[model samples]
Target: MEKRNIAISLPCTGEEEWQATREPLMSGWLTQGPKVAAFEKAFAERHQVPHALAVTSCTTGLHLALAGLGIGPGDEVIVPAFTWVATANVVLYCGATPVFIDVDPQTFNLDLEQVKAKVSDKTRAVIAVHLFGRCLDIDTLRAALPPSVAIVEDAACAAGASWKGRPAGSLGDVAAFSFHPRKSVTTGEGGMVTTANAELAEQMNQLRNHGASLSEEQRHHGPRPYLLPEFNLLGFNYRMTDLQGAVGLVQLAKLDGFIDEREQWAQYYCEQLSGIEWLRLPTVPEGGRHGWQAFVLYVDPAKAPMPRNEMMEILQAKGIATRPGTHAVHMLAYYRDRFDLKPDDFPAARDCNDHSMAIPLHNRMDAQDYAYVVEAIRQLG
Candidate 1:
């Protein structure tokens, strides 16, 4: 294939995902049902969590995590300034303030010092994001936060990732995962929330189903078929359909293999691209096994032959796609205007905002594609 035809990411789904949807379609149990339960069970077990609730999307899953944790008005949630907007947005959804903190530019994860400085009596939670598939050091963050402050793992880009042998979803009090098309595994557009606490899980379960006291399965299997569930707390329709659940199961089953393949290519890219001094390659943390969702590179405009954006343009002309690691939420219009923020307010986030670049990294890419991307980047040097 030509360089221009190479995509940043292409879902590795095919006939298997199509076939998995057959049962859900034939039974007409398209809504959340047996398939969703099965997918949740498999996901929870894989992540070593006792409960995993399928939701509409990671954005909604994050909302559920905060709501289940009882985070609301007058509370604050710590968030790394360098992550996807959803991380900070979810806190606001709970009527809680998202206390933004600078990030460690190298890791693109939370700066623990900032976390310590920003946390307070009103701090109810910290949305620890494992940006770019590198799992966060949850143990250290837990030690840093007060016992009352919960850690919500924003594992949106970290499926199959781990820290010190503990999976990403199992490390935090509760974790939210994305199944967007770009992730290592996908259900087209869906998400799952995993937690070990039964009480919290029950609350999230109810909230995802419009705060129903009992599940649809409970009603369907009960003797009184006409009885409707009671509502205790207000909730949203965040349930994942059986069709999506079916695809999720198949995707979940293949997650390990997918991660392994990506990891290999990531290593190869690191080895091959290390020679370019002006380009900073990604590095997995000491105890973290990165899921390799996207292999993001940091371009130093001062030393590089061209500016970061110029290099991106040149690559685009070569048909190789690239994107920033993620946006700096504080720089976005809504947050900047609402908070009266400046670009330099968070220096590291601003630096990353202008320099971090994510090249093509996905399961669909073969050895030739990887080599082509590497050569194209090396040529830039």
Candidate 2:
């Protein structure tokens, strides 16, 4: 086995992040203070939404959104079968049933027809994930869905992604974005929720901070600094730290550049891999600006010289790192046994789970790294 210098994903960090952290650390007000407020404000302004709340993780952000929307037992939330398990797990956290829908084989997004077929009177919300940083067609989903069903955009992979000139975070009734290390723009580990609804924002805000009637800053900056806040509703401690917020500020500023770099590399991959009958590259739907979170491609084993896993192993042996795009959540052990799900229940997702592979396409890679990955794939003959 050869030692590979390439990485599957790497956060593009620099002196900006290090410099940004200094003030927050020196000030000694490290727990969701002014920096977190600034990050939320900036994120809200960038997404063109009325409110954005910083959270500890995208999972918690999703939980906050579902809980805020009053989802609980007896309710059904539709989610894609092919996505990170967290997308479905959050539905479970709210004690609501997650009705799994299949994904579009071409775009790897939630299939609209499956969505239409699965919706029921018990359906209270739908989680539309922007898989691989490509925005889902909100108009199509909105038209297919009943007026009562709420849409929660799972934009964990989408930071700079947009659809028809509208940003991803502003598309749904509520949205959750991740700033995990693997994301285009990262804060090591953080998340944000965006929404135009003030009421929902307030609900999520309270939910993230122990259901306090007032935030810590609100209580401390007021006429009575010693006064304690009253707990109104049940909540969780899902607040983003000042350290992460400070890092997020730097990452947010460089988000566009990061996306652009990934886009360029993705285009390069497409160009290099063109006419490879066995491989199917990713696609960006019309009016969609992909954030290019990962350049995932499908391997048709019938046409391909070897199986998808074999191809991955070959690439690994040749000094390249790769991964399965993501899991078919319904096929995972927890969801499978709990919901009695079968692979054939959502064929598209199962196919994706079996065939899709993600190649290296992060800001950390240079021309040499890109060439190496392309050459390694070409050698699959």
Candidate 3:
């Protein structure tokens, strides 16, 4: 097979998304109004949650979740050292200390033992990251946590993913999902926050819209023309626009289909690439319905034909794209200096940060693309 370029991810969007935007465009209301509300409602139903609030991005959604939970400067939030920087950044956004912990090497999820060990009187929350669309055992984690501590799910890569039989949004105290182009669902740049707690949901609603007592839709329909919402708390302009909402609705409908296709190809990788002893393929853990956001592999430098970075370079030369699944936040500049962190502080996270490689896997790719990637990796052996 001829070598060809394969992107790490591409949004599964087309004319349907384009046409969906028209309704929002034709209508005069363009802010976070009716369309956003409808998207939120549909998202809640899909995720089996009572409330789902739309936000500008998952980072903002996380901030809103933490803020809604009343975590502040004096508090500490436990986060897996291995994840997108936003997971830890959101804690800092709330002026809370982010305590980094190691991850389980195989699952790339947080180690519950480290989480339990890290908890203290100052610990207000633990951000359970459903990395690479594979959820960690939330039930076990929940049982381990104290009643006072909250669970804020960093489900950036988990949309259709589940723990046991429960969906991502329903497992934690509050969950944030991404709809970035890289995610299974795409609304260009948007996110949704889901929770069962009514008071927390209410607080997040206000927090996403400048702490407004009434939403724009409510204010417009109200009889009092001069009344403005009473701002009781500081908030951010993290509202998702009507255009994104309309597109989000279209993408949300196709989510299951997208994951199904990706999962099929992911399993193909596992079957075809198994003999490369240096390569560690990701798998759907028991009871886990992975959303298949990306098929990330752990390339062991010790036994591989070349180092992970060199392997990526060879692929890049052949018009294929690859990326490290994500970085160890503690190893990044800000967290490193601020906390005096060393690269080896969280060993598994450090190893994953250097070795986890995300190969092409998305709704846009076909069997040809999957086969091409497999051939290329096997050739490296």
TM-score of each prediction: 0.99, 0.98, 0.99
lDDT against the true structure, each candidate: 0.93, 0.93, 0.91
Give candidate 1's whole-model lDDT.
0.93
lDDT of 1 by residue, 238-287 (tens): 99999999999999999999999999999999999999999999998897
Clashes of each: 1, 0, 1
Q: Pick the candidate with the highest lDDT.
A: 1
TM-score of 3: 0.99
Candidate 2 per-residue lDDT over residues 68-114, each given as its tens digit? 99999999999999999999999999899999999999999999877
| TM-score of candidate 1 to 2 decimals | 0.99
Order candidates by lDDT, high to low: 1, 2, 3
Pairs with backbone N, CA or C atoms under 3 Å apart (clashes), candidate 2: none
Which runs in model 2 stand beyond 4 Å of their true positions? 1-4
- lDDT score at residue 173, model 3, on the 0-100 scale: 94
For 146-230, candidate 3 gives per-residue lDDT tens digits of 9899999988899988878889989989999999999999898989999999999999999999998888888889999788899
By summed lDDT, which 10 consecutive residues of candidate 2 come out lowest? 1-10
